[model samples]
Target chain A: MNDQEIIEQIKKGDESAIDFLYKKNYRMMVKLILKNSGTEDEAKDIYQDALVVLWQKARNPEFVLSSKISTYLYSVCLNLWRKELERKGRHTSSEGMDYGENMPYDEKERIHIVQKCINELGDACKQILIYYYYDKLSMAEIAEKMGFANADTAKTKKYKCKQELDKKIKTQYTPSDFLD
Target chain B: MELQEKIDQYLLDQLSPADKTKFEQLIAGDSHLKSEVALQQSVVTALGNTRSMQLKARMQKIPVSMASTGNALRLKWIGIATTGAVAAGLIIFFLTGTGQEKNTESAESSSIQQTTSTEISPAVVPTIESTTPSAESQTEKAEQAVVVKKQKNTGTVAPSNEIKAFDNSANFDDIENGNVTTPNAENSSAPANTLYTETNNKLSNLSVTVDNSNSKDKSYQFTGSKLTLFGDFNNKPYELLELNNKGQKNLFLSYNNEYYELVWGQMKKTPLKKVSHKETLEKLKVINP
Candidate 1:
């Protein structure tokens, strides 16, 4: 069933509706939570809380659909994961971690080398790059999250970071450079 | 754009299709551009890989804290409106007590007991201003205004309104009160009663829709939870409907103009039972009818 249909069934207290929802999104939810520094249990807890929230909102007649269910779910999971990180008093540097199972062998090695190069680059460059690319956060989100002046400022910083990375890579040339 | 600018735009997937083609052509013809593009790409790829690993490793060490105290969550909700109601009641009790005592003293001091108009006025004001009793009336007016505005704007009423309760405030009040009432005052409540009063009645409609869906044919029976609608902890249990459907099931519950949906799946049986969505009507429903 579509999300709306499932949501309708769930409102009526249908058990199967809950089952179907869990099955469809559990894998992606787990992956998302794990990527946000959540363990398997944390992922499960956040996912469960998200489900309850969904259920509560579904029962509330006032809430209108503004986006796809998956997007909403992902947003909730992300928020919860971020909260988890904050509660632990740890800063998440999700930089240089390989979570993409779909990466090709050559691409993976090249990526590793590029990551090393980035590490060699300044910390500012690394943070900007991670904020923009790996997090897939919008310039606005990044600006707000990182305390940038504005989206324009964040974009400028990102541009400078990219330039620095490029400059560093040019200085250190290797034929099998990607393989390192 | 400069070569660096073009390369940056290309890496970010911001270049137009035509620009992308031009850039690709330029890179193919020039070994220098190719090398530059490869180097830039490598940096991005490496960052992506590193971030993913970091996130994964971080997740491994981190344990999920409970978002809320689950033990309190269910009961807390069950008592939500009741807590509010209890608080309001206490405030009213104190105010009325003080007012009555003052009125008695005034009567003793100066024989003015015909009405005690000021004292009575304050007591009534609290009842009205508390927002518990008069919410329906205000909600009704707001809904009417919205309907009129929508009709004027669109020149038509939506089809869903045919199924939806036109008198939302009244129906909400009735539902919250636990009255087997229908939204239609003009049309008899008999039809809606048949629809909601029996498990068999709702099943026929749900089953027909489920049977027609494209999924594989499978029959399963599972008990559903009904909303608890009482203030007192002790109340007779009401049996919830058992849903047997193929599609992803979501149970929608409405209370006091608010709506909630509960979703669960792959369950041997329903996990949650008789959750109150924190509505005053539930208290009324259990008490009045």
Candidate 2:
């Protein structure tokens, strides 16, 4: 099947699609992990993780496959291995590292905090914000998916959700907490 | 427009050129505005991360039975073949030893045969052969070899080697201050060097194409990893711009005419500072060059 068709099957939770995806990409994922100092068992773990990530993306109504499925799977495995390497404190020079590894620790922490606050926004606000910002859904689409009266209603809901989210974050964290 | 809407637009890069310039001036002039924008940008980012994490959690619960059936069978075959090879080698060793002993005639010839048998025996035969009185000892050695080979075949030899590598490096203080010989130092570096070369090749060849026109909602794929950017506009179907990153994470692609800039970190098209196409090209040149 074509990429779109496969994606559609995955979205519908087709077992065959999942099987096909795992079968097709498992070798590449295993090879990647093995090359990165992981064992066959670890490769299996990483490949499973990558597949889960792909499955998650496929299940999301908002997710679009920007790259070939194999490419996307390969990227996921690479990132997982990089993170694994970092966690193990086995990170070598940039020659083998991925780009943007130098993101400030403080920034990462701040993003983590904001994510916690977003999660606390409850499912309604969370879905709306994700659809609007991350998914880049138009107001009309958001309204339709969210069952709002119209686009304007979705806009108002989104505005309020942002306000509520901002308030939650500000109340929990001071500006210094993030800056430091 | 409300301040929040303006910030959202600014973060998403939906602001007009004039408004974008004005927002930048505001950010530069006011620390509070700068922090507010920063906070807002973080919220957008957090939302993106939260979504990814949630999806990951869900994906983990998927049944392993859904994995390819062929893989399981292949591993089984490998295990069986390894077992057979170990058994075959043991049989050959025994057969050669018996045949040689029977063929030997004079004292000198017998002595030579004994020497040769003793020399080659230690390698395939376990140390227990000399010490153990029980016949079970032979089976034990064979089993051990099979077990070691099986573990090796499973690709699990790296973790111990990795641990050893770390331990050797950690003892550098001792090595520098004293004349201690580090046996594991060589063992550690061998795998790491081989792994590095192999990883580098795999990483360099890894590429993922970002389709600008695929999804109605402008959702970008991120795998929460470091990324290197490579832009290619000449591809057919969707305009292809490759993000050659280790893991696909938090990339936002903006399509203008035929040009595409796959920005790292920022999930939205908007950056706090205005970035012209010329600046983007310069950035790509820095990355690729």
Candidate 3:
């Protein structure tokens, strides 16, 4: 079944939907966890936690998945695993946390402010920024995926969105605010 | 170009080397410019983290299930639910605990089998001698013996021990029951037959018996590069050994569910099927003989 259909079945509390989801992703999830310093049992546990989170989100009527179900699940699992690693004080270098260690308080606050600004930039700009900065997609690729006329159009839009984000960030708080 | 655009390019490393050097100089000269670059870098890092979190969450939404028998399938679901609850609690505890406590807790949890020898048989007693042959290791040997005694009393059985040893000179019945005496056994005047028993524990425990009578070479060595398909673990077939074609003596020992590929007594993790102790010993005999 398709992702939407699976979501509908889950919303209807169909057990088979849950089974279907588990059977489809178990191997990949297990491999991902195993390669990331997790044992077999730990992989199983993380998979289940991710499923539970998906179930809860599916059950909510207001919850909308803008991305594919697999994409959403992957993100959730990655977040959970990173949090897990952080909690355990295990090395996170493998997960691209080179700058995470010994981050200054002001730098952290600045990032937090920037994140808030990005969040307020509306879904379109947020997605574009994520696609450009996070996903590392080329402007042409982002334009094609996001349904823009051309790469140049996407570039201009991204610049404007970034400017708006920067403006919001600067207006939200001063450096002195972080000192307090 | 606007300073903001230049800063973005600088953060992304899109600037030419000369431009980057100039930007660095500018930042070094101006505290305001330095702070701006740092803030922009932080922004990029934050966005990267946000994207990572999103991607991880999406990947996790995929379904997972284990292969199981008819009645066992039902139990598997029940086990999943139960374990999920337990895992949730553990995650909370891990998050709340201090860093040192978390490390201690994780260490204790992983070594639970070592501390609690309730069900599994002591399968490594024979292999331990070949692996660590120092006078200072008497305490570890005694501990292993105690574990074996406890396993013997519990009446746990291993499928691996059922296979007879390959030594034509030794009685099949005696070897099958792990009643063969080693040189150490003879020297110490003690019976040194290594017995194996299977347990439901996922931890791998394997022991190999070296036939030292032929060479008087107290140390056993394995020389093979091709791993042979020997047996299965939970129905998953795995190639257990890569035999050295040159006929070099090598020690093949499996302990605690880990295959130690010892090349000249230096241990390295080898990718091999988790097999019964009997299978490993039999394979060792085949390679050596």
Candidate 4:
């Protein structure tokens, strides 16, 4: 499909279009990262991240892509890899490197606990939260997708899911229980 | 619930200027509100990380890693080349006629073969007279073939129950090397009682026509796998038909309205022999219907 057709399908949240976009640009994106001294795994991660960004942006009704989709994806990958290189300190000497490279023990523990809590949530609650926060889909779109009667039903469900998740996460947040 | 929504709004940066300023002031003043917003921010961050991981995992599952993709493209090229060679061989096989007829007739037809010539007395001369190509051209068609209903005599006359399908009495030499024009070719699906059993090496390049005349224009086609030749028998459309009787396989082609038997195995060695063509084709149309 042409760029506009792929854009339209992605806007409608077509899963195949995401797969198509990912495969069609995989080699080019990977080559970019490899030429910049990134490993294959690192290249795949950066490219997938860029494609996810495209998926999230295309679903926004107000978003207008002015250039070819390939050009936009190429630019996103380039910018993202540059940031990665800077973070790794590969662009400069490591003489002034600090111990701030690793995540704090407490923060990592909290993140693990949060992921477990999210997984323990019921399917509907989990999907509603992801759709709202990560996918950034509007309430009406969620209603149609989740087969709720209307936007109000979807909103009400999101509120309940968030409250349940908060309760779940709070109950698991004792540092003494996870003192490793 | 109201406080919780405000905390979510502040964490997501979705609150307006006035609401954001008020919420920040509240966060600075109250330690509990600040901790609540911090807890919520961590949850949203983790959610994004988990989703991104899942999407990447899905992409890795898609088919054909780069290492294997190159091999698949090479294999496809090899397959195309093999098919082209097979088609070229068949075109050369049909354009040049092989050897003449050799008797592979089974015991059933041979037992009645001696009776056929004896039964063809002076009275049967009038019956054979009507067996000429001009007489049968009225009902002749290129796609039409016969079933082995008249297998009694490999020579000519059929018994009472036997149905004669071809007019085999045409002059063999005149039919083979004559100035003949082919009929309009028609193609049809192979019926349950099909005339030709596909060769283990099925000649799909059947577009080659017999070059009896000087012009190299090809009018013969195996139209849709039916072994029909759309060539001329004196301006009439002539067809080739395959007849299977008992354990024997017989292939026939026509020129000047006279049918020549194309011996199966001896194709390269056998000359084109004038034999049973019309009577067998007539029965083939009956059985196919």
- Note the B-chain TM-score for every model: 0.25, 0.25, 0.26, 0.27
Please provide, for model 2 over B116-177, each residue's C-alpha lDDT reduced to its tens digit, 9 standing for 90 to 100: 01111212211111110011122222222211110011111222122221121223333322
lDDT (CA) per prediction: 0.42, 0.48, 0.45, 0.50
Tens digits of lDDT, candidate 3, B1-289: 9898898778766789999999899989887777666666766777766654554455445432322212343244335434543565577678888423333212222222121111221122111011100111222222221121101111122322122111122232332222333232222211111111121122122323223243321223322322222222211111123322122323343322244344532233233333346754544333221
Candidate 1 has what TM-score?
Answer: 0.35
Per-residue lDDT of model 4, residues A6-58, tens digit only: 77766655556667556555654665565556667777877777777677677
Which regions of candidate 3 deviate over 4 angstroms? A1-101, A175-180, B66-289
Could you tell me which 10 consecutive residues in candidate 4 chain A have the lowest summed lDDT?
A91-100
Q: After best superposition, candidate 1 residue A178: deviation in angstroms?
A: 4.2
Identify the candidate with maximal DockQ.
Answer: 2
Candidate 3 per-residue lDDT, tens place, A1-180, comes to 345656776665444455545544554455445545666666666666676567655544555654345434444444455455554455424343243556777667677787777767788888788776654566887797789999999999999888887778778766344331
Interface RMSD of each: 22.8, 17.3, 21.9, 33.8
Per-prediction DockQ scores?
Answer: 0.07, 0.11, 0.08, 0.06
- Fraction of the real A/B interface contacts present in each candidate? 0.14, 0.18, 0.14, 0.14
Tens-digit per-residue lDDT, B1-289, candidate 4:
4897777667656778998998889878876666677677778767776666666677877652333323343243234333433443455466655533332222122222111211122121222211110111111111111123111111122122222222223332222222111110001110111122222122222322333353333233233433322223222223345554432446555444355665543323234556655656444333222
Better of 1 and 3 by lDDT: 3
Q: Where does model 1 exceed 4 Å of error? A: A1-67, A70-102, A120-122, A131-160, A170-180, B49-68, B72-289
- Per-residue lDDT tens digits for candidate 1, residues B1-289, read 5777677678867778998998899889977667767877776567755554443443333332322213343344335434543554566679888523322111221221111111111121111011111112222222211111000000111111122111222332323222313323223111111112121222222321122132232222233421222222111111122222221223432222223333432224222333354543342222111
Candidate structures ordered by TM-score, highest first: 4, 2, 3, 1
Runs off by more than 4 Å, candidate 4: A1-14, A34-42, A56-66, A82-106, A174-180, B75-289
How many steric clashes between backbone atoms does each model show?
A: 44, 4, 47, 18
